[model samples]
Target: MRKITLTLVLILLLVQSLFSHLILQENTAISTTSQFDTGDTAWMLVATALVLLMTPGLGFFYGGMVGKKNVISTMMQSFMAMVIVTVLWVVIAFGLSFGPSLGGIIGNPAGYVFFQNVSVLTSWPLAPTIPFLLFALFQAKFAIITPALVTGAFAERIRFWAYLLFMVLFILFIYTPLAHCTWHPDGLLFQLGVLDFAGGTVVHMSAGWAALAGAIFLGKRRTPNTSPARITYVLLGTGLLWFGWFGFNAGSAMGANGIAVQALGTTTVAAAAASMAWVFLDKIWGHKPSAMGACIGSVVGLVAITPAAGYVSIPHAIFIGIFSSWVSNVMVSKFPKGKIDDALDVFSCHGVGGMTGMLLTGVFASKQVNPAVVDQGLIFGETTLFLHQLVALIGASVFAFTASWILFFVVNKITPLRVSQEKEELGLDLTQHGEFL
Candidate 1:
């Protein structure tokens, strides 16, 4: 009897060990599937901060270009954008971007309020190491700066209240849909294999075309003869913008990987090449290169590389930079013919540069750099990619321009789009704020 009891006890112990082993294997599999890494999380955190800095950098860039009288107002527009867009993004924009798909038109509203399905531990497919909230903030910066770009069109003219209303409507109706179409995983553009690695078409091109519409509707600044308030401020603003752009491009990689390194390298090279191209072009056309030329060239290059950063080779990036700068320069020179005084030349630098980059990307993308990219190459022989690129460029431009034009007209009809002529001469600082700098 004693022997039998001992044997039973040993059998029970063996069964318990077997169950423990199975549990251990299951846990290991779950951890491996999740696979969140420290390095990737750290990099995403830094990148998020970097993108946030670009808003103020843009503020300075736009602020410096406007007449001195409107400097404060220009700066205020950027500040307001940061605040207003952040609110909108948290409340609805984040949901519309990354929430469950709604037949590919927009994201579902289930997560619209944020911190619902999102938490410190929650991860997104876009950046698995980072919380969904972090990714949302990173994208919010893009949304903020885009509308700020439009302020250049009607600077020193539009009322603050009217501009605020326009931004709200624009964010909801225009920006959100474009973002959903281009960046969301199930987005039609993404499904169609349209690659906009960053925000070339979505951010820069959209804003540029909208600026054109605003300029047309608002009419020219009160005094077309006035010069920029402080060239020094413009130079300062330009430097900051150039510096912040590193994060803008590299951070798009969303991880600390070879792709991120490649993006950074290409972005730096493109900006340098374009700067030189602009300087040489200016010298060839007239005399010495101006600060304005250098600043504009750098920005154009940055804008151009935005979509192509991770997909193209370094050499291709250089070509894109030089080509985009030249195109933008030419466009700027002839902008007067259109006679729409886009005060800061958003259309020339962002609009033309973005369009040029998108087309050039089609020409330059290679399967050698990223074998996963399908329909690759233009010079190396794939024509389908080029055709797809053309379609994206045309589609984005047409839709953005047409929608913005109608929006501008509607806003103009309901409320005046520009400040009075007398107010313009005095400067926005005094007219709008009742305070002189």
Candidate 2:
């Protein structure tokens, strides 16, 4: 165990040393063309804060759904990402994600190691009004939450330290490449004109597939307790997640412009519509309209509209919400939980919801909403964008799921990923962290 840990640390240090270089000799080297705009900058700062808040919100959300003995362990998984991923992002993950293009596949790790060229004086090419440092900070929040979202799958059975190792590997290999592909200007998906207004593909889809991999890898928990630890915690987390989603969707516009306003409106209506649709659907299915159903439905709606928030109209956003909610709800109902044991249905809500949203974006996206769209959606009689979205969805999902399963296997080899049967019965709060609620 000590040898494995030492080897991993040494490898990381070696990579850091190899990539470390000064990309900017002086701040004057930055582009003079992009002028600073205070209004956009201010809004982005707020947006960054809102996005960061979602991690702890996710903690509460996942924590409440796990057994009481594992509550702290579950929430800590989310909180730990804020610390671990933040440091990694500053060190090399950010550059690996958004640095200069490397053949349209990934960023050059040497381009911005240690955020060497990122500064208040500089700005990202995409978000010209905000400081490059601020842009990096905002993106770091997304990186932080992706692995955190996976915790819900194997919530009660994962070893804390092993999970940390898996998180690091997953970010470096899986998340960064996907983010680069979907978001960076010169990336393959971006060049192919794949539209992801926020992160239906980059964040939610990756997390969802990774969760499925985790559920399968970790197997079923020893105790099959399904009752949530606290419904109130789930509600509190839902409130925080909904509030923070405005920033998640609107903030993707990278400016406080009309596009951002449209995104906010769409995000709002989508969540509301999905929440209502979920409860009504529950009644139709003969189940009582439960708060848990409402929360999950709203989140699924948020996930579905994310890729289309800025590209689709208000009414189309509602349709995306309704359709995504129904699909995810059905997926949750039909999932083989007794065998696969995705403790919180993360794959159903996030993976299926994100895919639904991505495809619907191809159906509802309009050039009228954003002139950057090269082609209108299928509804406007164009098939090109829809085809591109479908191709991208299948490709991205395959990569995410395959890479995540390999990561789980590698991490398990280095250190056991699942707790022992004895430890599992004791609960992770005691066995993993020696703390409990």
Question: Per-model C-alpha lDDT, please?
Answer: 0.79, 0.91
Residue by residue across 1-437, what tens digits does model 2's lDDT show? 66766886688778657655445454447665667899999999999999999999999888888888889999999999999999889888998899888887788877677777778877888988888999999999999999999999988999988998999999999999999998999999999999999999999999999999999999998887657899999999999999999989999999999999999999999998999999999999999999999999899999999999999999999998998989988898899988999999999999999999999999999989998889889999999999999999999999999999999999999798988999988888999888877
lDDT of candidate 2? 0.91
Backbone clash pairs in model 1 (N, Cα, C under 3 Å; residues 3+ apart or in different chains), count: 1
Give the Å error, residue 288, model 2. 0.8
TM-score of 2: 0.96
Q: Can you write out model 1's per-residue Cα lDDT over 102-210, one digit (the tens) per residue?
A: 8877787444443344555556776787666667777888888889888887788888767877887778777887888888989877777887878888898899999
How does candidate 1 fare on TM-score?
Answer: 0.89
